[model samples]
Target chain A: MQQQVDIGEVVLHHAADAYSFGIDPYFLLEWHAWEFMQLGPFNLTPTKHVIFMVIAALLVFLTMRVAGQKLQQQRANENAPKGFANAVEAMVLFVRNDVAIANIGQDGAKFAPFIMTLFFFILYMNLMGLIPFGATATGNLGVTAGLAIMAFVVIEISGVVKLGPVGYMRTIFPSIPGLSGPGAVAMSLFMAPIELLGKMVKPFALCVRLFGNMTAGHFVILSMMGIIFLFGHLTFWNWAIGISVATLILGIMMLEIFVATLQAYVFALLTAVFIGLMQHEH
Target chain B: MLLALLQEAETHGPNSPFEPEFGLIFWTLAVFAVLYWVLQKYAWPAIVGATEERERKIARQLEEAERMNAESQAALDEHKRLLAGAKEDARALIGEAKTVAEKEREGLLAKTRQEQEQILERAKREIEAELGKAIAELRRGAVDLSLAAASRLIDANLDDAANRKLVVEYLDSLEHSR
Candidate 1:
């Protein structure tokens, strides 16, 4: 049976270049505070909290890298991975093989660096959304779209690289360029827009997809919490029953773990596919 | 959707950073650089180094132990084979010596017995020669005595030849009867 969990809305503002509220693109872009700005326009916008996340990201990168480094030691190959490093390599290889390389290709290994990075990055960002007083960087479209744009750039550049100067346009369309039967022209015209739309929609789709999912989960959790307060004013019975919302909220919290990993995976997988598409034909 | 969302957001308020254009670009570049630099420099290397080092060390140790074990087992097997060979060699040597000693003893015994038989046979031959010489001498003595006795009994001038013949006949008769 499917469980219906309803979540409410999150208000985001675009009022200023340097908005201070959470979950807003304006704020994310404007994140640097005055103190951090003194260093030649470098963003000092990350709050101590954002700084914490930065720190967390750093730790993740370091931990994984160190593990990878040790694993790479030449003689170590004889023994194979062990302990924590074993576990970590297994995870990395699994993700690389099953999701990235499988969907992508051999050249896809290079993108493993990007995909793995994004997976952890987005995963942490999504998880950070749940923490009280924690900023969900993912809630902002600027961040998500920025990520999506990176994918777009990589994908387009990769496609161009794969198809080359003369063949690129041809690869995008089904028909030969000069042949113009009325049906052919019509078909090309129709397909061209659809192809254009498809290309344009990819990043936008990714942006909205990730943004909706992350934001929705948070809102659902928040709404469940709001229920207690929403009903708290009415009756003793309402207050008591509303307390049960805590359990449901906890349940959602658990579900958030699954959602977080899944979103991170989908995002990374899509990135690989996008990157892979550059080198590969339909 | 971002544009639409922004347009809707525009309805909410008069905004300063009105567009995502340069704002996102600048921040993304900034954030990515900073994160990459900091992580690659201070954080990533260390953590990756540690984990990889750990994995490598564990792997190395396992390999070392395995190699050592194999070497030891090989040495043990060699030693056992050597020991067995040595034992077999010792037994063979002992058996060989025993055969050699038995052949020597038989040869020595046969040599001594042959020498003893030769000495006894020579002594018997010498004694037999001496006895034969003694018997001849006795016969000469007997002839002299008999000649003296016959001369006294003959009464002087009887013919020596006749006496000699009588003596000879008597000797011959005695020999036949004996």
Candidate 2:
């Protein structure tokens, strides 16, 4: 019973209203739908993660929209981009040149917009999580899975579109060149399911990797802070926990920031590669 | 109400970490799709197009600048070539003028020397003829004096006019026969 209570308290403290300093923005927002306007039949309540996701989405939209306008207005000039425009443009170019072109080849230009969208969107969502009041949407498995699903769809579609359905199937199951008749047939049949599962594994890895990294980092930070609460009665122990673990927590927070950026990059990079790999066999 | 719902969500399952909520997935997909569509439609093309256009423009400008530089260099080279040709032509003209001047000086010297020589020869011939005339005049004067003396010695008492006339006629006949 004590263990259960401790676990519950820790979960509530970490995942619920963190710090209780009113820094938890979720508590500030009203969750009740006025009258009969519930979201779904499954009693789906809009969580803080959803709100943060929307905020991230809006941020991406507004930035790109403004940058797009700036780009349009300055179309004729030969000067470099400046300020916020410059920053966004650098990221866009990075995704286009390094990520998209390097992976997708000549046909990469067609998908630059989509790849750019993915990179900036993921980057914004990741970075938002590091803020005081913000929660990482990507920390949620459902969100990461959704993102992975989108990437998976793009990869599969590009593969199917570039290589016909027959060719796409052949990508999964290859016939041995020298083997004739039943042997090659048996080999292909044997490899088909495995190859299909291999395709699914890419997105699954992306989902789990992002979710795990983000969740683990936040948990470590929360757990480190929980140490002070764990030894609240012992003043010396609380001071020691505060002094020692506080530094480590700060370091980990910095690391979390880095991981946020890195995971975003990884997600975007992998998405580009997956899409590119589908289009080109090599 | 929101806090109550959140508390409900927080306690729905202790293993909430592993739970994949359909609502969140649907919302994420919906939100991301909308964002992607808005960006792709209104933002990306413009941003990317402008950037590419700017890049191409810069490349073209660089190429233009390079081409202009090359053309200017060629022009300078041509100018240098023309100047060199002009310098060569001037040198040749100076050489030709020097040679012509040298020929003219030589011709003038030769002509002046020939004129001097002709003048000296004419002066020499005139001097010789004058000297010969003077000597002949002196000889004639001496012969006339000697003739008078001889005539005086031969016939002091004789008729002077008749004797001189005879002598003169005799000398003239002798000169004619000789």
Give the clashing residue pairs of candidate 2, or none.
none
List, residue by residue over A59-176, the lDDT tens digit for candidate 2: 9889988987776666557665677777777788988889887888777877777788887888888888788867787877888898999899989889888899898888888776
The positional error of residue A149 in candidate 1, measured at the CA in angstroms, is 0.4
TM-scores of chain A, one for each prediction: 0.76, 0.86
Per-residue alpha-carbon lDDT of model 1 for A191-276, expressed as tens digits? 87778788889888887788778766766776666676556566557757576888898899889888888888898888888777
lDDT of 2 by residue, B62-122 (tens): 9999999999999999999999999999999999999999999999999999999999999
- For model 2, report DockQ: 0.22
lDDT for position A212 in model 1: 74
Model 1 spans with C-alpha error above 4 angstroms? A1-53, A69-80, A176-190, B1-25, B33-178
**TM-score for each prediction?**
0.55, 0.65
Scored against the true structure, residue A165 in model 2 reaches a CA lDDT of 89
